[model samples]
Target chain A: MGTKAFWLATTAAVLIVFAASRLVTNDYVFFAGYVVLQYVVLATAWNILGGYAGYINFGTSGFVGIGAYSTVVLHKLVGPPIPVLILVGGIVSGAIGLGMGYLTLRLRGVYFGIATLAMAIVVQTLVTNWDFVGGSRGVYIIRPAHVPFIGGYIQYLFLVMLVLAAVAVAAARTIERSVFGFGLAAIRDDEQAAEVSGVPTLRLKLIAISVSCGLMGMAGAPLPYYVTYLDPASAFNLGYTANTIAMPLIGGTASWVGPVIGAIGLATIQQVSTVTISSALNLLIVGVLLLICVVVAPNGIVGLVRGKRRRAGRGG
Target chain B: MADDLLSVDKLGKRFGGFVALDGIDLTVRAGERLGLIGPNGSGKSTLVNCLSGTLRNDSGTVRFDGNLLNGLAAHRRTRLGLARSFQLPKPFRSLTVVENLRVPLYYSVNARPGAPHLAEAAVGERCRELLRLVGLEAKADRQPQDLTQIEMRKLELARALAAEPKLLIADEAMAGLSNSEVDNILALLMRLGDRGIAVILIEHIMRAVISFSQRLVVLVAGRKIADGDPHAVVRDPEVVRAYLGE
Candidate 1:
């Protein structure tokens, strides 16, 4: 489908889900649903560079941290609306992404992976030292008692995240089918071959990194409002890194739908397990699921299903 | 020299202390068919790399169609109409046979000034034509892994052709093929030459290179030892001593 049509359909679906959630009297659904939706955005954003271009980014939380801090700084200065804050977050993170790509894209394979991991640590250290966003002590956000139309602040946050998820998924789907996506796929398969074949490899990679980081930052922009107490440690939590990478790997990295499916499935499990058991086991569950994915479905759930279908077709 | 489509002046490359290509001077006229041959570890592949901008030459200059090609990136060189197939045939593993041709068409061909702005349908049409040219229309949807070794080589050649290049370098494109398969590739290279595309065929298969090349160039120990009529160059004493070993 064309991007416009896909976007319209996704928006319609999100609205319907939001409308259905309104029927539930309890506020807990929105609280948990917000997180699941947040991963949906994070996973989709990460996949743009990590899955599509075959560059593994271990610093997802760094981009998210940038977004959250950008929001914190903006709130301190002018206290802009969430949308404006989100825009600023995306732009700042995208510029950093472009800079990071320029400095590190020449290093491939494990070296590139290490550079991104180190980048996350660097970002965390920087945020810890910077006092504008309250340094290591953290900052508290007092949300308005009642949201304009959504009634509850939590519900409003949920609705915003839902919209962002729709936007992220629609964007990914569009890129997956475009000429630009084909160039990325070529780069992923073989950088040298792609270059000799006339693909502008470095330029395409930088664009991927910028877009991926921008969307990730957008996902993080609303975090301060959601949690009320935002710290450098929480903003740059390594859990964000693990979950974002896990979602795409578990769902399938080849297509846009893979990361969305992975995020929704994995995040929902994590939320349910958190309530029924303990939050400490959340990372354990992720590790186990990732292990399963690596062993049994190395290409993820989508790849497994596609393999079965192809085999059945051949059999027939 | 003015009519030369590609001119290399004293091209040199070294890997640490080992010289790969030393002051190699060569020229190809428009639509010319030239065969480059040498023993293992000689500089035939290295020369192709320098000309195609895969590896930068430490010294000397390369001019293609009156444009000085020094320090240009590989993709930029391709945009300027120099294309080459790898010796081992590096096909995009994830892309299907036909989509493999689309990369060059979308990037190199369409980027040129006054080139037709190909819509999706036009791109598909062009991809189909390329697949047919390389006799890969039957396997258009198959992954590169599913193709035989010879088929992979054909796909490589077809992908290079997709750029609409002025000059093409086919590096051992028929390495593992049977005699009939080698003849097929030779005929294909000859056909490319007929279309006003200068071709440099680098091959170890002596018979195919001699039958296909109007002129032959021999390299030995990082230096050009012979360049002349194919029959005459083969009989040069130094070429026979260094390469033919007869």
Candidate 2:
């Protein structure tokens, strides 16, 4: 489908999913579906830099750590009742993303990838050692007072994440249509040609990374509040980084629906596997999907569908 | 703006101790057609790289339209109306032919302050117009991989033209094309120059070089051997021995 039609359908689907989610009000269903939305937000955020711009960030976990910590610290002082806390997560993560991009944006391909991985390691290490937020022991989040009749606390978390997911997807769409988006696409194609075309490439790249990281951070911010717990290892869990990349890659990088499809599909598989099979096997499923996408359908599912349509269109 | 659009003073680039370009001084007046010809490792591409901001000069200054262009990034220089085509065509593989035009048109139009922004439809139309100029409009919706050698070269020219550049550096655009194809490309570059776009043609094809260039420059071992009339520069003993190898 074309971009405009795809967006309209996505909006309708989101509303249906949200309303349907409200029907299943148990703690488990609320928690599991909310987790999927979190993945959707994080994965789409990652795609802003990785998929559309062709910049692979292995430091996604590092940005998540920043987001989680920022939310934990802020909520501990005040409370989660303020809805603006969600946006704060994005802003904080985006700032760190800017710093990371400035230092590593010039690095490309694997060298840049390795540098970002190292950055994640560094952040994880620092947070682990720092005692202010419990260090190795982790931070304790006292879940804030929930206003009655706004549904249960878990439902509120779901809505917060749904809106965040919406913002992430909307933001990505806006960037994809803008002039800066064209510059990133050019940089992805040929840096030299882009430079001579007058793209202000570094500025554009930095902006993309910042926006991407900020959204990712916001995705993680509520985790500490929802769970009422935070530790360095869980907050900086490297698995989150891999999921962000694998989901988008499997869904199809650079397309509007790529990350969403990848996120929802992978999260469902993980949820089913966690219940019936083994929690450890969840990653294995994602890994297999990633490998299949890389080997057979490098463009991901959306790409496959679009390719088939185009081929059929041509044949007719 | 000065009558000369670009002036290079003692520009140089080095890979380790091996100098790729050395003390190359040159000037191109507005709307000039200049041919930069050299042998395989003679630094034609290097000069273009430095002029187009792909490489930072190890020493010296590059000024465009009386503004210092050295130290500015490549795209920024392009915004200042300096654009170059790659020796090998590198169109955005995922984008359609017409979409390729939007990149430079937006890059040039957005990076400047006074330039008006075109709507998406206008941008798409302008892209088609550029493809038409280079005779690639019929294939506007096709991907770059769908293009043949001459068509790919045409796409590259269309992309460069989309920048609305004051000076366009066409880097070996006609290479690996048929003789008729070479003439077609020559006709296209001449048309661009006719529209008052300054052009620097880097080519190994001597026939095309002689026909397209109003002035010629020869580089050998990272240094300029001759810079003057195309006929004399090609015939000069040092230039002929070092650059032309005839």
Candidate 3:
């Protein structure tokens, strides 16, 4: 691992250890932290291609659902533990992403966006009708049959997610600065111009889709173990889609930390607001916030901050 | 004949029954500077699009550096050392001037096996050199939105140069520039050509066309009406009829 990767991994290790200790010490904290961190993983995964390459992927739930459903099916079939199941989910979802790219990456802008959204809907409908994973009724993992000595499974699960989230972030930044990163950025800026400049548009896009979906699969694989239950509605929820995309947009889609900050901020806000407001209106709040961000600070919080700092230095 | 560096033979293109480019034929030597010009909608840009692989030629072959370029994607054509500038500049709006150049420099240079791979700092240095070449180094950190029309044109040239192309087709590169600005762009194109990069200058500015072109080619209604010495091609009776209607 490079310096950035090493530090990120270390930070994730510390966070996981800290969260595990908290799980042992406080049940309420574990409940809250787990939910927020889950968003971080999904949002970070979405950021890899969406933020870096400027390719908007609204079908995030499709990949997540694939991960969750595959985890359940694989575990049921092969009897592997949770960790191995998540890896299976990642591979399956990545394959699906690769396939999806072939069908839709050539389309630009609204067309590409709608194609991904349609894909998510199709996957959701498929899982809802399939009875193997209990169809719409859902499946229960039964809490992984309870590992007796593990006093803080929730924390351990959270730690696992944290490591994944850090990996996602580091990987995203690395790709952003790497040769492929420049290629994607060029493709985003001007597809024709990028091509004319010798950027391999299709190859780069396929690679991005594969990696992006792989990360989403990893982010989602732990859900069966985390919730101890899975249903078509829960597994293929559009809520995941909204969180994965909106957080990146609200935080700054082009930067690594944009999705991280957006996920943590929005997740915590939604968590708190649910107590004082209606849970059903959470997405409504997010929708309104996204609109405001687009109009006022299209660059997101990071852009807003940088604009402020630049102004402040001039003023001083 | 060394197979000509680029051969566009019997190229035909159409947009839904409207013949945008009708049976065009042209060729360029390894380091020859050529100018292609026509009135608006005369198929110059369309030919550029077809030759560069942005649009596949309907009935022709575009062999670049001796490689057949039919049915290849646009970027693949670029990797074969063919690059073009748009009539309107299209810089990556979000990137700094240097970063915009880096995308092409990174792609074209690092993509080819034996080519040099520039680090970020080295890429920045090449970007600055390109900027200085076009007299836009002072605005390296500025966004495209911040550039004046002439500066934008220079930046466009700089972006194309980043690819280190064998043939650079500049489409109306001086379209909106002042007289002096036009001279600046013409000078820059000349400088690129002097570096042994064959150039295709597509311009309507008669002086820029005449002065910059070693040979002039004219198109009327998508057909090549004339291709010869600049002084004689413009005076050809058919070229006159096509231009001023005799």
What order do candidates take by TM-score, descending? Answer: 1, 2, 3
lDDT of 3 by residue, B1-246 (tens): 565898888989989989998889899997788988787888998998898888877897778998989998887777778888999998988788888888878788767777777877887788888988888879998889999988888888888888889999999999878899898788888988789999999998889989999999999999999999999988899988877356
Candidate 3 lDDT over A1-316, as tens digits, reads 5666767765866666675565467665666677787788788778777877778898998999999889888867876876787788899999999999999998888899999999989998998898888888889886643354555677667666766776777788778778788788878788888888888888999999999998888878888888887888888888999888899889988877788899989988888787678788789889998999999999999889988998898796
Ten-residue region with minimum lDDT total, candidate 2 chain B: B104-113
Worst 10-residue lDDT window for candidate 3 chain A reads A143-152
Which lDDT tens digits does candidate 1 get at residues A188-256? 999989998899999999999999999999999999999999999999999999999999999999999
- The sequence of per-residue lDDT tens digits that candidate 2 reaches over residues A31-102 is 888889999999999898998789899988898888888877777677655366667877988988899899
C-alpha lDDT (0 to 100) for residue B39 of candidate 1 = 97
Candidate 3, residue B7: CA error in Å? 1.2
- Model 1 docking tier (incorrect/acceptable/medium/high): high
Candidate 2, DockQ score (0 to 1): 0.76
**TM (chain A), candidate 3:** 0.91
Q: List the residue pairs that clash in candidate 2.
A: A195-B74, A195-B75, A198-B75
Give the proportion of true interface contacts each model preserves, from 0 to 1: 0.83, 0.80, 0.80
